[model samples]
Target: MGAMAAAYGPLLPYLMRRFAIGVSVAGLVFGVHFAGGLLGVTASMLSLGRLTSRVAVSGALGLMAIGCIGVALALSWLVMLAGVFLIGIGFGALDLRINQMLAYSVNPKRVALLNGLNGVFGIGAVAAPILVSIAGARYGLIYAGGAAVAAVALLGFRGVPGRLRGASSSGTAPSSRRTARLVVIFATAFGLYVGVEIGVAGWMPTHLHSAGFGLAAAATLTSGFWLALAAGRFLVAPLTLRVSDSAIVLGGTAVAVLCLAGALIAPFAPVAYIATGLAIAPVFPTGVAWLATLNPANPGATSWLFPASMVGGALIPSAIGLVIARVGAGWVPTILAAVAIGTLAAFAAAARS
Candidate 1:
C-alpha cells in the first residue's frame, strides 16, 4: 500500500500530460486519494469491533485491486480521482491493520522484526519506479500488475486461522490529556514524514525532468531514491538494538535536514535524492515503535497514523505543486527544507512523548 501510495510519482508527468492538467492539479490527484484514505482509516477503527483481521485485510486488498484497474483504464478526471480515492481507502485500511498486528505482538515486533517489515515496504517503493521505467509509455501495465499482486495476497491471507488472525482491542480505551498530546505529536510528525517522504517520491521524477534530465534518467533517479530508502531500513534495523531508538530518530531527521540542504543546491542530481532517502528511512518505524512502546493499551491508536500520513501526502505535495505553479521548480527546495524543519519539530515533540 505504501508502494501504491507513492507509485504515482514518476507517472505524474505522464498523467499530467494525458489528463490535460497542470502541476497544481497534478498534486490534487493525491489529495483526493488521501481524503478517501482518511475515511477508510476511520472506518477500520470502527470495524475492528465487528470483523476479523483477515476479513478486513482481504476486503482492503480487493478494493485496492479494483482501484488500481480503475486508474489504469481511467478516461476522465472524475474517473481517475475516484480510482485514486479507492486506492487510498484500501491502502489506509490494510496498512492500519498490519501495524496493529506488528505493534501489538507478544514479542512486541521491535528492532530487527520491525525493520524487516519496513524494509520490505521500502523495497516495494523502490520497485514502483522500476516498473514505471520499464513500461512507462504504457503505464497501465504497472497498475494491472499491482492489481494482480493484491489479488494473490488477498487469496494468501485466507489461509490464516481465525486464531492467528488479527483482532481488535476490546479493553477500556486510554483517553487522557497526555495521550491526546502524544497522539497530536506523533500524528504531526507522521504527517510531515509523509509530506517529505512521499512528496519527494511523488515529485522527484518531475523535479529531475524539469531540471533538464531525460525521462529515463529521471526515472532512474527516482528508483535510486527508493533504493536508498530500502537500504537505510535494512542497515539501520540492526543498529536500533545498540543505539537508542530516540537517538536514531533524532539523528536521522537531522541528517535528513542536511541532505535536503544538499538537494537544494544540487537540485538535479540523484545523489542528493539518494542521501535524502537514506537519511529519511529510520524515522517512521522508530517513531511508531516509540509511540506503541509508550502507549500499549492504545496500540491500535496508530490505526490512524497511516491516514494522518496520507493527509501529509496530500497537502505537502499540493503545496509543492502550488509553488511549482506560482513560482518555479527551483523554489521547491525551500518547501522541502521547511518540511525537514517540520520533521525536526516532530522528533522534538516525539521525544517528549
Candidate 2:
C-alpha cells in the first residue's frame, strides 16, 4: 500500500494533467504496474533455485527504487508507464520475499501479529497522499519524487539480512507442483481481497463526493476505511489464538459482505464509508495468515502467494476503473460489494480444499 500511495498519491493529479488522462486511464496506468507485478512473480518463481531470498528481495527493492526515480524524471507518458512497470516488478519481488521470510522465520505464536504489522503498508498508504501533497505543494513534484525513491532504497537495504535468513532455512522442500498450486489458490483469494480493499479505498472519495460529501468529509471517510482495516488486523491477533482461523475468516467475510451491502444502501455518506471500512478490515491480513499456514517447511512459498495476491490487488482496482468508465463511478461501492462476496467464496473454497 505504501508503494501504491507513493506510486499514485500525488502523481495521480499530475499524471492526469501531463497525460491528459481520465480516471479510467489513470486506473489503466495502475494496471500497467500490476502487469509488471505479474511478470515479477513469474520471474521470482523461475529464479527460485538460482537466487537466495535476500538477493531476490534486494533486487526487487532496487527495481522499485529505480522505478521511483524513473517516475520522478519521466518527461513523457511512455516513460511514466515504463517507470510504473518497473515499480510493479520491484513491489512484487519485495512482497514475495518478505512474506516468505515472515512465514518461515517467525514463530507460529507470533505470526498473526507479524501479519497485522504488515498493515504498516496501509499506514504508508495513508501517509503518502498527505506527504506528497505537502511536499509537492511546498517543494514541487521533483522533491516529492526524490523522497519516494529514497524511501525504497533505504527500506530495501534494511530488509536484506532477514531475507537471506529466510531463504537459507534447512527445511525439506514441499513438492514443487503442490506448492505452486497452493500458491495459485492462495494468491487468487488474496488477489480478490486486495482488489476489493484497494477498489473501495481508491474510489471512495469520488463515491462519497457524488453522494454530496464535501472534500474534507470525503477524505475523512476514505481514511476511516484504511484506519479500520489497519486496526482490524491488529485487533484480530489475540482473537485468532482463541478461535480457529477458518472461523475467524468466515465470520469476517460475512460481516464484510453485510457491511458492503449496507454501504451500498446507506443514505448518508459517512455511514456508508464507515461501513465499507469496517467490512474490509480483516480480509487482507487474515488472508495472509491463512496462506502462511500452507507450508511449514517452505516459507518461500508465501513469497509466491504474496506477489500473486498483489497482482490481484493491482488488477481488481483497474477492473473497477474499467467498470466506472463503462458504467459510472457512483457504482463503485456496489462493485466492491461483489468483490467482497467473491472473496468470501474463495475463502470458503480454500477452506474446503
Candidate 3:
C-alpha cells in the first residue's frame, strides 16, 4: 500500500497533467487517501468482534488488488481519486491489523523480527514506482499484476484467524492510568515518525525537480531512499537484540537529523536523501517494539498508532507543499530537518512519559 499509494509521488507531475489537477488538489487527493486509511483501520478495530481476522485480511487484500488496477487504468480524475482512496483503505487496514498481531506476540527477540518484516515494505516501495516507470504507458499491465499477486495471497489467509485467536490467550494489556498516559504520548511520536517517513517519500521527486534535477534522476534517488530503508531494517536487526529500544530509536533519529542537515546544506541532494533513509530506518519498527512494551496484549493499544500515523501521513506532506510554494523547494531539506528533530524530541518525551 505504501508503494502503491507513494508511487504517485514521482508520477505526480505526469498525473497532474493527465488528470488536470492543481498541486493543492493533488495534495487533497493524498489527504483523502489517508482519510480512507483512517476509516479502514478504525472500522477494523471496532468490528474485530464481528469480523474474523481471516475475512478481514482477505477482503482488505482484495480491495488493495482491485484498487491498484483501478488507479492504473483510471480515465478521469474522480476515478483516480476513488482508486487512491480504496488503496488507502486496503493499505491502512492490513498495516494496522498485521502489526497489531505482531504486537500481541512481542518478546525481546521478536522485536528484531518485526523490524525485518517492516523492511520488506521498503522493498515494495522501491519496486512499485519502478514498475510504473517501466510500463511507460498511462495505463499499464503492472497494476493488474498487483491484483494477481493478491489473489494468490488469499490462499494463505486461513492461518491468520488461528494466530489471532492464540494471541488473545497469551497476554494481558494494562488498564491503569499509566497505560493511558503512555498511549497518548506514544501516539504523538508515532504520528511524527510516520509524517517524516511519508512526507519524504511522497514529495522527494517534486523537491528534487525544484532543485533542478531531471525526472529519471529524481526517481532513482527516491528508489535509493527506499532501498537504504529496506537494507537498514535488516542490517540493524541484529543490533536490536543487544541495544535498548530507546537507545536505538534515539540513535537512529539523531543520525537521521544529521542526514537531513546534509540534505539541507549539501550541494547534491541524493546522497543526503539516501543517507537519511538508512539512518532513519529503525524509528518505526523500534517504535512498534517500544509501544508493545507499554501495553503488550491489547491490539487496540497499538491501534491508536495507526490513526495517528494516518493523520501524519495525510497532513505533513501537504503542509510541506504549502511551505514549498511560499519558500521554494530548496527549503525542503530544512523543512525535513525540523521534522526530523521534532521526531527525535517526540521519542525522547515518550521515553520519559
Report the number of the highest-TM-score candidate: 1
Residue 104 error, candidate 1, Å: 0.9
Q: Which is the leading candidate under lDDT?
A: 1
Q: Residue-wise lDDT of candidate 1 within 1-353, one digit each (tens)?
A: 65686578877777888888887887787788878777777777677657777888998999999999998898887898888889988988877776667766767446556667778888888888877778875888888888999999987898643322234456324367887777888888889988998778877777777788888778878888888888898899888878887898889888887777777665435787789899988888777777777777675556556667878877888778877887777666667878989889877977866
| lDDT, model 3 | 0.77
Q: What TM-score, over all chains together, does every model reach?
A: 0.93, 0.83, 0.93
Local accuracy of candidate 2 as per-residue lDDT tens digits, 1-353 = 36354336234555677678787787766678778887887677566656776677778867776776777677778888887788888777666655555555557655576546666766665655455445442323543454476565656564455333334434324458877776666667777887776677677766776677654456555666666666666767777778777777777877877777776653764566566565566566666666667666565566556565667767888888778888886787788888878888888877887
lDDT of each: 0.78, 0.66, 0.77
lDDT of 3 by residue, 128-202 (tens): 667656665553466677777778888888787534522343233335788877777777887877778877777
- lDDT of prediction 2: 0.66
**Could you tally the backbone clashes for each prediction?**
0, 0, 0
